[model samples]
Target chain A: MQELGSFLEVLISGLLAGVLYSLVALGFVLIFKASGVFNFAQGAMVLLAGLALVRALDFLTRLGFPGWLAIMLGFVFAALVMALCAFLVQRYVLGPLINQNALTMFMATIGATFVIEGVAQFVFGSEVYPLRLFPTDAWIAAEATFPGGILINKLDVWGGVIAGLLVIALALFFQYTKTGRALRAVADDHAAAQSVGIPIDWIWFVVWLVAGLVALVAAAIWGTKLGVQFSITFLALKALPVLIIGGFTSVPGAIIGGLIVGAGEKVAEVYLGPFIGGGIEYWFAYVLALAVLMVRPQGLYGEKIIERI
Target chain B: MGQFKTSYAKDMVIFPIRQDRIGVYLLLGFALVLLPLMMAFHVPPFRTDYFLLAILLPFLILSLAAIGVNILVGYCGQISLGSGAFMAIGAYMAYKFGTGISEIGLPPLPIVFAILLGGLSAAFFGVLFGLPSLRIKGLYLAVATLAAQFFFDWVFLRVKWFTNYAPSGSVSAPELKFFGYLVATPVEKYMVALIFVIVFALIAKNLVRGNIGRQWMAIRDMDIAAELMGIRPLVAKLSAFAVSSFIIGVAGALWAFLRLGTWEPLAFDINRSLELLFMVIIGGLGSILGSFLGAAFILIVPIFLTVLPAELGIPITTGTVSHLQNVIFGGMICCILIKEPLGFARLWQIGKEKLRMWPFPY
Candidate 1:
């Protein structure tokens, strides 16, 4: 009974972790679909956004604003800053390089990631800051009878709820809006969409803006959960494996990949760890996906096109 | 100019010009012989020799790997994120082989052979990963390679057999030597690396200029046309992977033998892989000279940043220094890309062109 309870706890923690991973993957998918460039900076963007949000809140408090109002103001101001970053990236960095190859564009994104991480460090010193996403008193106590009891954090539950709502909101925005429709059209075929007079440039910019917002939302939740640190950017590397398993183009794949990798790593660590000295289970998720990739190269939902000479 | 009156035979020469060939020969001879002598004479503790062997050996290893990758990525148009993992395979394989042989009282030559063999094993993995390139395009292929990186890193770290069932879960190279010359010394180690790099780089240059290289370039420029032109995509890609893996594996062995001498799996972690890939990308793809230039830029700039600030009495904190280094390094990449997206090689070519007309404005 104790073993069963521990397994259940591991599984639940993995699912919550998966939700955050999915959020980061979603940012990659948005920019990839619109611009066809993998935003290598997405991970760093998460770190920068979270740091900015914390700074905004702190700045407001220093100016004598109430705590709650300060927090709210921080959220809005951070979003605006992210949007501006998107616009500048598209206008100056990406727009000029539109004629360049994918490798060049990818290198540019890497450059962006390094530059952002540095600027963030400069702006907000390299210190881990705790983020208060919600009230500390918001707790729900539930007890389950087993051989031994397990303790679960109430805040983890809130993180799940907020992440779910955010995912749904994003899904609706992408599915319903005119911008979303155009974005999909461009993703499907850039040249054909351009021939039909869609403003390809603006679509890329807006989609990148949306990706930044997605990053902001993920960062806030994750930052609050883990505490904000410069090393948090490495966590974003976790999303790449998810992206690979989920299929680069599918939103549903991100969610599924997240759950599989998250739960997979936890279970492996708990069950198979003693066999090989343990901590390597952190990388086991990726090994599992590699096997999966050998079977399904285009990913689960990615388009299957056989190239002919 | 009797040299200018040279026949088509002279024009078609591999070195084309005599002075250039002499320069190349002199440079190679110096690297192979002179570097070892210099290292033997010098013993400034915590100074140049240590920097050259400790840091530069790994950078050279990464450069060789990047060159291998450049053949596939820059020249052949396939993107990969798995170079570091392939390197890990070489490192671990060398460790396993060296230790296994030493247990039987075998010499270091067998270990050297084992490291190359280790690289061949990584090439096998590369082919397995490259199989996806037959179906996927661009970013998809890159992601597939990234999966390989993660998988190999996990397996090597987790599997006890790879680490010789070590308690610490980390592996180290056995003390290596060549012809009874202790290779553990910085000078000896640097010469070993210098020799290997020059030889492999020449081989890579030859491969790129040969028929196989042309076939890879054909595939890169336009796969459909290459396919139509009777080139098999599978053969071209897999061969590129094999060659790339072989070079990367050798570099990985050198990294183990020379650089860390002792390291955990994280030494060849994803960050290292990305850094190497960036070295190739920022340096220039598809150019042999770019491999060296990129390695120099990526490796030397950070050192320069670290020392230059201190020399000026800035007294920058290590954290701030590293952060600033990251920013400046990244910014320089952006600036280089923006100014000449073709990379540093092209910039060098442009400089050469300008130099020919240097005395008076054209």
Candidate 2:
């Protein structure tokens, strides 16, 4: 019973952590679905957003703004910057290099990754800053009656709630909103959407903006947990395996894949890590994704890819 | 029109034009003779300064690795992010073979053989990680390769056997000797790297120009069509992986033995993989000349950035310089992709064409 309780607690914590992974993976899926380009800069975008927000908050607070007002202003500034980034990316990168191969676009994003990281470091400096958006102490205390007691971090719980809400909101927006429908049409077939008189470039811009918003949320959650640092960019790499397992174009796939990877790594680290000298979490998600991909090339929820020669 | 080949044998030569052949021979001759001549004559930069030699050695090693990556990514179209892992395998395996063999007190096998063995070991692991390419491709294959990168990193860091059970988990190359001649000095190391680069570059050029190279190009263009045309995807893809890994592994061994005499696992991390990929992309994807060009550009720029400020008596810190370097390098990559996606090799080709048609717009 005690072992089972401990396992349950670990599983819950892992799932909670998975929510953040899902948020980052969602950013990748949004960009990929619309543009068919793997944005390697997505991680850098997360880091940039977090760095911008924290710096903005710090600057605002130092100027005698209220805590709540500073937070609100920081978020608004981040949103504007992200929108500007989307526009600039469209103008400088996508517009000029239209109809290029996927690999070329992928390479461009890598360049964008370096630029974003450099800009972030240059603007905000490379110092590690603790994000105090949420309370540090766990809100839920362990009960003595339960075996090993199950303590839940309030920040994680809120993170899970926020992630769930974001996913739901996105789903509704995609299903109901006109712009979202256009975005879907674009993702479905770029030529078809363009032929139908849909504003392909505008849709792309909006999609990138949405992805940026998702990146901001993800960074916020991750920053609260790990603190804002250069290493946070690496945490974004965790989303890659999540995307692979979830399928590149599937929104729900990102969520499920994130959960699987997050829980799977935690479980592996706990049960199998000690024997192997720990740090197995780094590669565990990738290995799992690879194994799963062998069975389902299109991924668990990804649409089957059909090639006609 | 100035020079014409009369026979098919003459036409089939790697450099059919006499001028082209002369130019290539002159370049090779200069490379072979320049450093040794400079050292003998006590030339200022070559004698008093080891910095140029230091940069050249890694540039040569990285060029070789980039060439390997080019075969896989450019020629075969299998995007791999695990080149660093293969490099690690080569380096550690070479370290093991080099140290383990010497400990046994057998007749000392040449360092060249140990390096080859290190490359072969890397090839073995490359094939293992490459199995997923059969099932998935493109971005999926890339992520799978990332797994290999992380896995090898963990293995080299955690598994003590690979590092010879050192307390710090870092290993240094044993004395690199070729038949009792120690290759210890910077010039000797530079020569060693240059020799490997030249030999491997020749092999890569020949391989790409032949039947195997055609198979790889066929697969890269359209795998299904290649299969329909009797080119086995399995053999082509795996061979590409094997050959690419072999070259990369040798480069990795050279990197350990020639440069950075002592190293840890962090030396061959994801950033290294990204740097090599950038070299291949920025150099030219399918062209061998691009590999050398890309390697040279990536290696020299950082040194230049560091030294330029000092030379100008500027007061910038190293961190700021590095940060600015990243920004500039990143911007350059984007500019190259946008302006000339075919990279420097294509630019070189364009220059040559313009030279041929000088003073004639047509």
Best by lDDT: 2
lDDT of 2 by residue, A194-273 (tens): 99999988999999999999989988888988888899888768999899889989999999999998899999999999
Scored by lDDT, model 1 comes in at 0.79
Task: Summarize candidate 1's per-residue lDDT along B1-362 as a digit string, tens digits.
Answer: 33573486656566665666898889878767665566566645433665676466767777887888788788888888888888898888777776765556755446567777778878887888888888765776776787788777778877878887889987777877665566766666776777788889889998998899999999998889999999999999899988988888878888877888788888888777777777776788788888888887788877787789889988888888778877876776677677776588888878866766787857
Worst 10 residues of 1 chain A by lDDT: A135-144
Provide the lDDT at A170 for model 1: 74
Relative to the true structure, how large is the alpha-carbon lDDT of every model?
A: 0.79, 0.88
TM-score between candidate 2 and the true structure = 0.97
For model 1, the superposed segments whose C-alpha errors exceed 4 Å read A1-8, A62-64, A135-152, A191-198, A272-277, A304-309, B2-13, B32-51, B54-59, B101-111, B357-362
- lDDT by residue (B1-362, candidate 2, tens digit) is 58777888778778766777899989888778876678767887666546545677788899999999999998999998889999999999888888774456544347888899999999998888888898788888988999999999999999988887899988998898976889877777877888889999999999998999999999989888999999998999999999999999999999888888999999999999999998988898888999999999998888888889899999877777777877877877888899987789999989987887898959
TM-score of chain B of each: 0.91, 0.95
Q: Please give each candidate's TM-score.
A: 0.89, 0.97
Instruction: Please give the lDDT score at residue A69 for candidate 2.
Output: 96
Give lDDT: candidate 2, residue B49. 42
Model 2 bad stretches (over 4 Å):
A140-145, B101-109
